[model samples]
Target: MSYAGALWLAVQEDLYTGICNGTRENGDINRPKIIREESKGCLECFDDYFLSQCFHLSRPCLTFLLDFIKTRLKKNVFNPVSDSTSTESIILATLFFYAHGFLPSKITAKLGLNHTFAGEAVNTTSKILSELSSSFITFPASYNDRMGVAQGFKNISGIPNVVGVLGCFHVKVTPPPSELSLFLNTLGYPSVTVQMVSDVDGNLLSVEQCYPGGTREQYVWERSTICQEFVSFRHGQTWVIGGRGLPPGRHVLTPVERSQLKTSAARRFNITHSRVMTYNQHVFGCLKARFQCLNDLGTVQADALESVACIIKACCVLHNISKKFSVPLPREPVLEPVHPTQDVKGKEGEKSFYYMEETREDMIETCFGQIRDEEEKEANTEGWL
Candidate 1:
């Protein structure tokens, strides 16, 4: 080639390379530079409030979490050598991501971490918590435990034999390429339905399962393992209370129709039922409030559905852990679940409905029948006097 032509080609190549590496001001994307935090000393400087502000966990709870998962995190999340990121930093970064819906790049910049470690930390941390879900978020299986939960519910709501409050909530997600309709909720947005059972104190007893955003709540419950347990009478003599929409069974109770509330006793019963049912609302509110990641799962995609589910389970486990340590919920606005307008009938058939209706009648008679008799007796005495 001629020297002049070769020189021209070289000049063009240099200009292209310069453009590729140019700053954002020059109409090119500038890659963020990582500034690694090498010293463990920085961690010592953060007070409890600051730690909670960043990670949404108290110091002792954070310590407990670190101690609880440090060994596994060391093995799974961090390398022994050549990985300078401390276990605490990784956890803090992951929790920061969960507490705030920050992008990985922002997290890296804030915590002095690289993109790779930040991503791995979130994945590993969620996996670890998901694995611990069975331990942390458990439904009472034993008779004694079930009874204790029942007693707690009765004390709080004055409703007898309510072992848990059953409900479902929605979490936003980006729809996948395949089966896109499954992820779109009734409100015309992509989401996943999280079915849950919570005890009186808003602690989750079971995260029964996650379903496609568009799945019906009644369908999810009918297929839920807890509902099966109830159907089989595995948790004997204990029934959960929910909205009138749920198909009531011998082990589950729902309020009567609005027409049935004509009597004062029936009105009282429905009010009490509502009081108990709202605990499920409280559980969802506190869970989402405590871990904002459940509110914004940006890292999640359609292909990684299982990962997102795990992350949700992990947040639930963390929620229970926070409750265990008495961690106060952050001061955030709690979003209420939308109530169903129409009733949802289960596939359990009419026979099951009659069976549960009988139980509800018996409960009402036991609770309010004597009061009615007393009122009549007092009226008679007043007339005589």
Candidate 2:
């Protein structure tokens, strides 16, 4: 049987057994009564596709996530009133809110619960998950982990020693009451800029969301804690690739400009660099597609910037978890191309430019030189023939 069908059978079996309590509440007479058994039936009947659609996660992932966070939730979320709400319900409510960007009232209405309960559940769940961010989104600390990351990127485009793709995503938030300009990004929307480093499969290795939307990418990177950690990666001979506009550093490589390509090796390097960046782009696309809340969190209260940050972080944790299960996106993700910028402003920026230029050149020679030499050798052989 399919997973959903098997789950239905299990729920049916549970109904006959004494495992489920028959107690149910109908706070709203217009809404259908929800009991322990029915809730299991509803969730279990979710085939993988529908599960991913409603919750932005597959059954395997949802199951794993619940088990993973169960101990933490019990310790933190258990209370007199909350005892009635199952862990599954809390997760389902939070996932629905994240996937649909629905208000707590709407989510509770759909789940046949009161607004207070649903709102609390959503907040508590998001808070709990956000607290678990370090567990889900982690940088490769061990040598083997770093090597694995490097190998994954090397497989992508023959790029050597790349541990992650450095990128940023703009999360739309409601216009704040004060200093509104701080939240407005280049797109003229009130947003929060989230810096992230994604692996080859688009799983986030590091996440930082301390900056306002209008903050410069370079400024965020320079001040980020991960930036310091990457200096260690550089010492380990592992680096990350960033997109256009960001100045490269000892631990970061950016795509060389087309005009600056002096050889076939450089041209190929640029193409490959662009291709690798698409992985980063795909990640943002998938993230927003799965958790629509990130697309526009404008409904949030103006003063709830901390809540917004928590929600974004929780969504990122969920994104990485969904990626763990290999959950397919419900729709095609829109990928934005990397755009170049000449706004390298500062002494540090200038130094990074020159330093990474040499690094990029060395990479071009080390990684692609052999292929270029082979091409030349083939041309000579053809000429002889």
Candidate 3:
């Protein structure tokens, strides 16, 4: 049998037995007559018809998955739950959630566990997810490496030397009490400016983060580090604004001057430039646009786009893309069969038991038959050969 087919059978077997035997109300094995009959039939059916459905994995792969779970659980990063909840149950429920995006009740039926236990498990697992999100999700270091590098600009327009061009935009966030409110609050305001040294590519380099309420002088000074990094990397790159170039000189503009210049430029270009007033504005805009483009992409594509954005932002600040930074991305790992036989027993003569029942073959055939009928109806509607 194919590896995947074998793996599926093994997983079903493991789950059925693991739940029935692992949870005992009293010392005696709670083998109801119905459960025993079902299990016997299931075993026979498995041996005769689905023997090929078993899977194996390398030791390293198994270790990796276990270690990942252990690390998260040990840190108490999981969602907060009642003290009575079992960590093992939480972890299993979490795995199901991640794989299928279902709620606890749905997973309870699939795993053959009590609904209340499943709910508690999901809560605990959510804590772990929350912790992972906070600790692991980060912008790529490539962003720093590629900061201060511009792309797509080839010509100049009307202003005396441009000391810096800022990208401004507002990031709309739902008000307080929302899940994303914290990040919005961190920005201190909705609008922000992103100042980068412009390049031949018409892209801004050396991105920096800042509040929206700061004065023009404060904004420029706040971004001075990024500017300095950019300049250091590209020794001779000039800063252009409008049509003029600002020779290498420390120039700080007042709020009035910056506002007036921005207004005049917007008029001339017929493009709205008010959004480029703060660092938060710029970063949020860039991120939103990039994420939207990647929403439908596969995991690899999404990851690549995220990396590219980070690198581009970094190059804009550093004026080079060679620096290294680590970016964490979501990864899906292969799951292995969970054997209940390995679990510890509380007392002598205590043994874990599982119930597996043979589902009627006719039931399976009927389901497939229904699916075929549906497909034929759709095909007829579409007039497909």
Q: What is the overall TM-score of model 1 with all chains considered together?
A: 0.79
Give residue 169's lDDT in candidate 3 (0 to 100).
Answer: 26
Off by over 4 Å in 3: 1-67, 74-89, 95-106, 139-264, 267-385
Per residue, candidate 1 scores C-alpha lDDT tens digits across 1-385 of 1123245334324433433344223442322222234453334444455456556788778878877776676666344422434666677777776776553464464456688877876777788888988899888899889889889987776668788888877788776567668777767777877788899888888896677777877788788888888777888888888766566667777887786666666677787888778778878887777777778575345455777787788889988999999987776547557655444754736464466686787787677566678899999999999
lDDT of each: 0.71, 0.72, 0.32
For model 2 the local lDDT of residue 29 reads 34
lDDT string, candidate 2, 1-385, tens digits: 1123245334424332322344333452322233355435345544455465556677888888767655567787354233434666677777877876764453455455677787777777787888999999998888898898899889878988888988878877777467678776666777777888999878898888656777778888877888877665533877788866576677778877767878888888888897888898898888887887788776444445677778888998988887777887767788843433436556443464466668778878888888988989999999999
The worst-scoring run of ten residues by lDDT in candidate 1 lies at 28-37
Q: What are the models' TM-scores? A: 0.79, 0.81, 0.26
Better of 2 and 3 by TM-score: 2
lDDT of 3 by residue, 1-385 (tens): 2223245445554545544555323543322111333333222222312221211112232234335545566666435433322444455444433322333354455445678777565445444443343223221224332232322111232222223443332223222233322223223542222334333332343344433312242334334564454335342333322211112122221122233433332233322122122322333333333222211111222112332233223223211211112211122212211111111222222111111001212222343345556777999989965
Those runs of model 2 whose alpha carbons end farther than 4 Å from true positions after fitting are 1-42, 45-50, 77-86, 104-106, 110-112, 232-235, 257-259, 299-304, 337-342, 347-356
Model 3 residue 243 CA deviation (Å) reads 26
RMSD, model 1, all Cα superposed?
11.5
Please give the distance, in angstroms, between residue 253's alpha carbon in candidate 1 and its true position after superposition: 1.1
Q: Give the local distance difference test score of model 3.
A: 0.32
Candidate 3: worst-modelled 10 consecutive residues by lDDT: 350-359
